[model samples]
Target: MEHAGKHALVTGGGSGIGKGIALALAHAGAEVTITGRRADTLATAAALHPRLNALEMDVTDEASVREGIAAAAALRGPVRICVANAGIAEGGPFAQTTLADWRHMMATNLDGAFLTFQAALATLGDDDAARMIVVSSIAGVRGLKNAIPYTVTKHGVIGLIRGLSEEYMRRPITFNALCPGYVDTAIVRGQLPGLMRRFDVDEQGAIDIIAKGNRHRRLLQVDETTGAAMWLCSDAARSVNGQTIEISGGQV
Candidate 1:
């Protein structure tokens, strides 16, 4: 449950689940590197903890990921924990989904995980132990109406982790995915206005509508997901590989 001197890297660590995980790891005494496209946001999150360091990197860009990880490793050490949590969730009618929207989702969610894992793995030596966690969604395990592209990307990341776990079965690294349901995140909050407009309801009404999607009919706290990520990083989960830890209220 403790990581005294480990080096952990979390993408999209500026806010929400990613930020929560980064802060938790830092509190556990790990030298944490948090990366995001926004420097200001990253800095704000990093400032919350002395163990947290901010790194500006776009998960969608290959060169950025490679260089950013290398720089982080140089400063902190080889990454022992890598969390690929950078993604966007945009819901729209399937018929109205353009190719551009599909590509953007694919790039940020699926491709971002691929690049982050590849680059972080490169920092580890043959004998080094590492944990790779992907922050997918509940939509990954089932079809989500009106969110075809987002669901596809989430599912794609789950596949990426599964294949990677098998491919590196003999290695000291473990690959896993965390599929969480609707949480009280900025992403969820951002969708509230749209939901209100579409449903002709108030803010609280929109939130209630979204909460109904979860089996518990509630918006989960960020700590719920962060706790799972912290457990996967612990020694107890060393054998937990090629698995998906669903954080939804119940099975989808």
Candidate 2:
């Protein structure tokens, strides 16, 4: 129970990698608040674990984020660990991507993290050790072929963490980003059918296409990314800050 009595907040915690990380934190004994836009989903996720609490939050809206975090913190305690995991992964050719699409990605992926980190920091004590983990992607570090919007938003998240890390260099809080490639999540599963339709291939072929995004040509289970998140929130990583821990099979 290393995280006993700690209040951990995870955005987008209804499913996929976010759900995995929330469960990990709860298992480690933290009072977990899982936030998402869907109340039903949040409730369902919360039902799965006694330590998990559900909060309906639209991270894209600054007011919603601020209000949601404040409410959660008031109910549990100061947010000692925050997982900014809410994001959308949409891919299209640059010429086909619209301004609305770009803005949507930026709103949820970039602005959401900024608002979440700021609000969580406000609840943290000056002398307390805290963790802010932004769930970025390998695309954050390097460009992807047709995911321009996702790439840009992820890069922005890395920049957010880097800037915050430097600004709080002397503080007890640590900022970091987790860059995972092709994790086996609902987001990736949603792409399989599209890939099949686009390439006229079978399910395996579509899966292989997504898996090839990683250097090892395999899809990572959500647990793999969760492990990295757990480490970032652990005491062992006290000295690790302003770092992007890449979970791709190999270097991009």
Candidate 3:
């Protein structure tokens, strides 16, 4: 167990990329606390493995994150690894996007990461080794058409990681980001209906349009991203701080 006895916290750990990362860490012998707004989802994920625990938390809410992560640390010990993976992905034309949608995106993707990292760092001291990973997207590094709000929030997260990494340069803590493209997840499935309607095509046709966005013209599995996350947490990657690990089938 490479991570035996380590305490890892994964936000939005109930499903999608978060779930995969949580399971991987648990298998590596970390005491993982998976948090999400859905109690049922958290409970279900916890049921899947003995090392995974459930914590009901909303990243957008400062109080919930502060208290919930504190509680998690109390139960599982100080959080040595924090994965800010909870996010909402919705996209539309910039002019057509409402202010409310923009706020919602920023609240969850940008502000949420801010609060998550802030609270998680509170559980660690200067001498304690830790890793903080922000689950950004390919959009973070490059702009995506018709996804202004989502793109903006993602870019903001990358900025957050870069700044944090510099601030903590002398400390044992490291900050990094993972940017993946077109992962095979519930989030991607949900986009199919919209794509079909917008493109006037069948499901497979819409999927083809989406898959082409990846360099290899195929969907990425959750484990592909999980492996990169696991590497970020390893001692071998100690100097790889403030870097963006892009997994888009090829270089973006």
Q: TM-score for each prediction?
A: 0.98, 0.98, 0.98
Residue 125 shift from truth in candidate 1, angstroms? 0.7
Q: After superposition, how far is residue 239 of candidate 3 from its true place, in Å?
A: 1.0
C-alpha lDDT values of all predictions = 0.94, 0.94, 0.94
Model 2 agreement with the true structure over 50-164: per-residue lDDT tens digits: 9999999999999999998999999999999999999998888999999999899999999999999999999988898899999999999999878999999999999999999
Tens digit of lDDT per residue, candidate 3, span 1-252? Answer: 899999999999999999999999999999999999999989999998999999999999999999999999988888999999999998888899999999999999999999999999999867999999999999999999999999999999999999999999999999999999999999999989988999999988988899998999998999999999999999889898999999999989
lDDT of 1 by residue, 1-252 (tens): 388889999999999999999999999999999999999999999999999999999999999999999999998899999999999988889999999999999999999999999999999999999999999999999999999999999999999999999999999899999999999998899999988999999999999999998899999999999999999998899999999999889878
Model 3: which ten-residue window has the lowest total lDDT?
Answer: 122-131
Candidate 1 C-alpha RMSD relative to the actual structure? 0.9
Q: What are the RMSDs of all candidates, in order?
A: 0.9, 0.8, 1.0
Q: Any residue pairs clashing in model 1, and if so which? A: none
- C-alpha lDDT of candidate 3 relative to the true structure: 0.94
